[model samples]
Target: MWKIYLLAAISFLNGTSEYVIAGILDKIAEANHISVSSAGQLITVFSVAFGAGTPFLIAMFARMDRKKLLVYALTVFSVINILIAIITGYEMLMSARIISALSAGVMQVTVLTLAAVLAAPGKQGGAIATVIMGQSSALVAGVPIGRVVASHYDWNVIFIGIGAVGLLFSVLTLFAIPKTVAEKPVPLREQFKFFMRPRIAAYLLITFLWLGAYSVVFTYISPYFLDIFGMSNHGVTTALFIFGIASAIGAQLGGFSTDKWGAFRTLTGGMLLHAIALLLFPFIGQFAFLFYVLLIFWALAAWSSGSPIQFQLISLAPAAASIVLSLHSALGQLGMAGGAGIGGIAVKNGLLNYLPWIGAFTLAIAVGVTVLDKVYLNEKQFKETQSTLFIK
Candidate 1:
């Protein structure tokens, strides 16, 4: 239990580090004397690094001891956060951000892998969720706390705080996490080979599309509330807090649902709900309560899908769990990269109000893809059943 808490704390630090920037975008821009547009590039850089680095890092470190790798990653993450806090120029800050992102990407995969391995049979969902809840809580609490810190002090304070937390977690991880050697080292080529499967390719596509659509609107949410709804910073924070709370609930619910209904059903239903909520965002704008309600639904449905997706991929490729999970993290980051880019373009091009429309459209595609996946699964199951009956 203490080990679980330690792992979750590490996750919490990673999440706080990843998202603290979002809450302090304006402050960062002002402090650096740069345009908000340019400052937003920090997210772009981080996402790119996370997307491109996770797989490579995992492949390169595959043979290394898990405990050592985790400690190294956490130390690097803490150092990068400290660098970010002290960096003077935008370029330096961006570079540090990328470094931190790489560490975070690696940490997330390692932590999840560790969690799954440590869990008893049939408790993988709960184990994974225990750590992931940290991320969700960061969304719920970290952003608001970051905003407050940025507003009251310097934006750098956010990174400093995150760095301090990372340092603490690093110590905890180093001491608490048991030394576990890899069962068998998977070479980089073998890792890449997993993608050759058609079903694996389809699942990767699903992750990409689903995350892309979700991040599109989520990336721009704070600005959307401020610009369209005329919300104060407090209001924006409040709204995000509400959304995060809902997401945490949704994540818990999702873990339960995955165990009961299976991954495909949970994913399909979650995607459908996400699409519906996004489509309704514009309609609910007139009423604050309605708008918040929709936001809650959106956060719940969208955030709940993550664990099921992870569970499904692991089930699909049990032999290559680490590599497949690495790819999953990379693809999800790619989705975030795509979404943020699209949202930024839309907002810059004076299509801010139409942002939710893009989310809706993208989600519709995701739903279509999910439906296809279901059909594929059902047909495969039926064929297997027929073969069994014939043999009997």
Candidate 2:
């Protein structure tokens, strides 16, 4: 249990590295004398590297001892952050972001797998959820903290602190985690087979679209608040704090709702709420009280879908749980990348106010995909169809 908590702490660090950039997008842009839209590309490239590079990297190192791999990845992640603290060149920063993303992805996946392997029987799900909480906890605490710190001192200080903590956690991981035997590696081809199934592919697609819609608005939220509502730094921090808390609550609700209502029901309803919230954002900016309510609502609705999405994926193909999970992570990040990139394009074209509408449109497509899967491509439906054909 202590070990699981420690792994969660490590995940919190990795998540901070990935997410804190959004909190300080304007600061980084001002420092480099670039447009905020250009700064947003930092997010796009990091997501691309993480989404495109991680699964293969995991597959490449599949047979390595999880304990050792975790420690190594954490060390590399720490060293990269430390370097970023000192390096200021734009190209250099981009290169560092790529390295950081890959290391963070590997560290997260290894920790998740290790958490399950180390937990007692029947407790694996709780253990994995604990680790996920660590990541979600980052949004609640880490981003607001970064925003406050960057307002007070150099933005680089946040990364320096993360690097120091990461190194310390790596040492803790080395001493605390027990040695475990490696399982046989699943081939890339074998994993690809599960993806070929209609239901499996549609679930993954929904993850991409759902998260992509989230990223479209959220990737530029800092500037959006500052520019439109004229929020002070303190106000921005407060809003983000509220948003983060809502996100954490939403994740818990997602898992609960999945258990209570089943995955499809929970997912479709959550996603509908998510899209509606975004679509309403453009119209609510003038009312301060309503504005904040909508922000919290948006965060809650967006994150509430996460657990059910994963639940649906795993339920669809239980034998390939790990593979499906890895694919889910990859697609989720790619969705974020696509969203951020599209938002950047819109921002560059002077369409900042239109971002929420664009995000709503993307989520609308995702909702449709979910409905399509439930009606036409679900496994139960396919099985029934096969039986009917055989009877004829």
The C-alpha RMSD of each candidate to the native structure, in angstroms, is: 2.9, 1.7
- Candidate 1 contains a number of clashing pairs equal to 0
Off by over 4 Å in 1: 116-126, 259-265, 376-392
Give the per-residue lDDT of model 1 (tens digit) for 119-198: 77998878887887777688889887887777677888788778787888788778888888765656767767877876
The global Cα lDDT (0 to 1) of model 2 is 0.90
Off by over 4 Å in 2: 383-392
RMSD, candidate 1, Å: 2.9
User: In model 2, which range of ten residues has the least summed lDDT?
Assistant: 179-188
After aligning candidate 1 to the native by TM-score, how far in Å is the CA of 283 from where it should be?
Answer: 3.3
Scored by lDDT, the top model is 2
Superposition error at 184 for model 1 (Å):
2.2
